[model samples]
Target: MAVLRVSPAPVPAGRRQDRLSTARPPAKLQISAGAHAADPLLSLPDLPTPLKEKILCMEMMGIDSGRALSLNPALRSTPLDSLHVIISFLLTKGIHHKDLARIFGMCPAALTAEPRRDLAPVFNFLAAELAVPSAAFRRVINKCPRLLVCSVPDQLIPALVFLKRLGFKDMEGLAYHDPVLLASSVEKTLLPKLEFLEREVGEGKEMVVRCPALFTFSVENNLRPKLGYLVEEMGRDVAEVREFPQYFAFSLEKRIKPRHRAMEERGLRLSLPTMLKTTDHEFGLLLQTADSSPTVGP
Candidate 1:
């Protein structure tokens, strides 16, 4: 049987190889030598590999990447290592990782803060100047994370000094509990509130130092309206308010006005503490049991 020598498959092997080589394979993605592979779905902004790493890193830390990035443009160029430094530095200062999420969320500047110049001196001032114990560092910082980004000489030291001058005896308590005072401006915030109270009550300095929370209140929205209700509406003297300065601490609309109205309706006049301090149920009980003859006593 004659073996039909089948013709060499379509073309010569060399020609087939030539055709395969000449015909271009589908176009490829040209990634740089050290660049990361692009995300498959979205063509993201052209960001440096390290910067993208920083964003991912911060997002993992529970910071709002969009807000933080927008508020702090420095983050664009901030080295990934710089973020790590800030994170590590805060952790060293007794700040928990969870706490860092809240802290940096509030003040993104802290995410890029210099470890020594910006941060170290804060603890130094807390320890040496303010005499805040090392252990209380976390409590103080967690109380006010803005402390980390503040200038030691410009903000913290001056605020502490001002408070001390005003006879704030419980420095530790102020640092931990009412830290927003330290962040407050002596001229813009603390002093103005004090002056307003002095004008109204004639004992502003003593009252505020006695109850530092007065500084946190809005003079326009809080102090003025509450004092107005106390003097003009309640027919009480400023001296009476001086005795219970925390009267400003309670919500005028929610607690003070309603309770005071409830008292007037029942003809039961209670002291500020007696009226304001009691719960709704207690205040109701007070209205029921107290002499309906309006027993007004400081």
Candidate 2:
């Protein structure tokens, strides 16, 4: 009976059409969490089998995997031929394979660096200007690889010139003991330390040459405190400290103070080495014997 009025309710204006049109196909959800992540090692081009083996060998020789991997990019950019040349040149210079591996492990950049542009000048300066004997070259470079990268005019030459001014004519000794001095800052490190020794202790280049190890010690921590203790506290002469500069190398808290205090209490005046170099057991024995000994009346 109501068929005449059973027509579907009039469609709302644009409702059905809007619903139909607005309904979009499910979007392809793209998660890029790990999909696009880069591999650190993959960024480097594949290395030759031999090269890969060599790197593995280096890792076995105490170079960490991360460091060895980090070197890959530089190695990739550097031609295999260039690496061979560098290795060959170093070998010709008397650097053994084991030493070469150690050096390269320590300074991977040297493996990729330009031989003539980056390394040759340093070698030349050491051999010719500094008179570092060819026989000792490998040993010195092994000790301080930074010498290969340091600037001749800026860093190395100035240090050499200053050392020469300080009567350091024995380049072989300097290269062996303090090649790091060639890589240190002339204005900042070398100058201030030299000035401190000179001004405070009447020590100069001669003292430094005698004990190149002095350059390796810190002025604020090792040199100043030890010198002050010996001079002001102990009333030791400046010349005495200069004569036994190795005293500065001993630990102030552990070795110097304890030994000095023991010696002072016992009225003993032993050489610096003897005073500080003894083992704990030996030192304790000395202290015990000193305590038990008769006190001589002055």
Candidate 3:
């Protein structure tokens, strides 16, 4: 209901003792945001009172009411009080009022989700299992808003357990830096990547631990082409990769190919670090030095 609040009138000095005892705290008023209430979104003919309140509250919180409604149609049926409860629950979790716009804008369905059943468990897992301090909850949640929607037992825990079993040592690092990996599905996203490493790069299974960025790469797009060029084209042994797992971090088309071509043009066979670690000008200096006694590839 739309409320109109008024503060108590000033009491005369002589009657201060009598009136002050009866005076209560001033009533707080909450008005919806945006233009005048008579605007069409709010003033639509015969709009239900609860939904009107929901839209008003959403606008007041800086959320795009239209997008949030489309993303979570349940907003129409959910009570205004329930929406407030969800906001209050998130605030208790260290998500500030300023953070609400981005969070709700990204996962608008969150506004309608059950606070204790659906949401609280994720927070509990972060605090109890991942060891995320309550003060740092905002940092983790903001890093991956999907954490707000993912289930504790079903999605997050299984992935965390899998990463741990695979020798992931930094629990706090994963929670704080890569919570998306935890939010990901084990069967769909994480497992297939590990399986690929076990089958294809069997000798260097531990390389992923040495270089976690390998998880972000695609087998077909990045790993396959680079490995193919290294072995089939350049005739280099795969052990070079085991020695420097950061080999995968370089660009195949830009840095790797150009530098390899420079070495080949000079008919010089340099070590992987010799080829990859130097700056462009330094590599030019190396090539100049190599040109004097260039060795032919056999």
Candidate 4:
């Protein structure tokens, strides 16, 4: 049999020098080329690959999530309209969680980080820019609301109050608090003010809130736990909150005990998850169980 002659495929002009070099290139260079060109899910400079992947994956999925795509530290610093646009985009995408990871670059563990994905930053940005009044926010959120994830009690209160102040009465579909944030800020004087805001807002609707359905005591310093006892207390009277099942946490820390107490009296429990769950059957609450020993403390 005749031997077949083999020849090397023609190399691109740009790659000839690379092929001639005997020294191995650095991993960083290889990664750069592989990531920038070959990998659509590559991470940018200064951000972890996971985070970069998380953000882009969410965006690629068209989820209307928040600013998971942004790289500038300064841009990340402010929750502005740009951030809102990003969030809205991600949310609208409604991408599946697993697909989100595959498209962007987030691991399952990273996706579980509630704080990093919290919408409070975006709300704060909206509140500042849109001047979301208590009544208007209530009205808008109530009309087409989205529930927030569970967080700390203290952290969640401020956002709830802010939403209330803006007219977002759809308490049934709001974000919850983070326990870590709550345990930190629970005992502060802000409790009374927060309660008061709720009462004041609820009173306008002719609804009576009977007990501090959502209450907290500082676990440490300013951190507070977003306790379910508060909602349980309110469930006694109000038609909506009376049957709420789970509890949630909040992001901001502001005291409003007197206000909270008053709302409780009206049967208006303000546990974000409880309200959301009551409104939408799908917006269920997830009460975190206590470990044998406290896993989290202020």
Give the number of the best model, judged by TM-score: 1
Instruction: Point out the worst 10-residue segment of candidate 1 by lDDT.
Output: 1-10
Provide the clash count, candidate 4. 100
Candidate 3 regions off by >4 Å?
Answer: 1-38, 41-81, 203-205, 266-298
Across residues 68-173, which tens digit of lDDT does each residue of candidate 1 receive? 9999998889888888888888788888888978998888988888998899998998888767888789888888888888787888778888888888888778
lDDT of 3 by residue, 218-241 (tens): 778887889889988899888888
> What's the best-to-worst order under TM-score?
1, 3, 2, 4
TM-score of each: 0.82, 0.68, 0.69, 0.21
lDDT digits (tens) for residues 1-298 of candidate 4:
1111223556668977887685433332111222332143243567654444444444545543353333223433333344345444444434333343332232222233333445454345335534544434333322222222324244455645544554444333332222122122333533453553345333212221222223332333222233333435333333333333122223323323443453444434445443332322222221121122234221
lDDT of 2 by residue, 21-89 (tens): 876333232222232222222233465644554453344444554674586566644554676688788
RMSD of 2: 17.4
Candidate 1, residue 193: Cα displacement in angstroms equals 1.0
Question: Candidate 2, residue 62: CA error in Å?
Answer: 5.7
lDDT of 3: 0.80
Instruction: Show model 4 residue runs off by greater than 4 Å.
Output: 1-52, 64-66, 69-146, 149-152, 155-298
Candidate 3: deviation at residue 230, Å? Answer: 3.3
Model 3, residue 86: distance off in Å is 2.5
Model 3: weakest 10-residue lDDT segment is 32-41
Candidate 2 residue spans exceeding 4 A from truth: 1-62, 68-81, 231-239, 271-274, 277-289, 292-298
C-alpha lDDT score of every prediction, in listed order: 0.79, 0.72, 0.80, 0.36
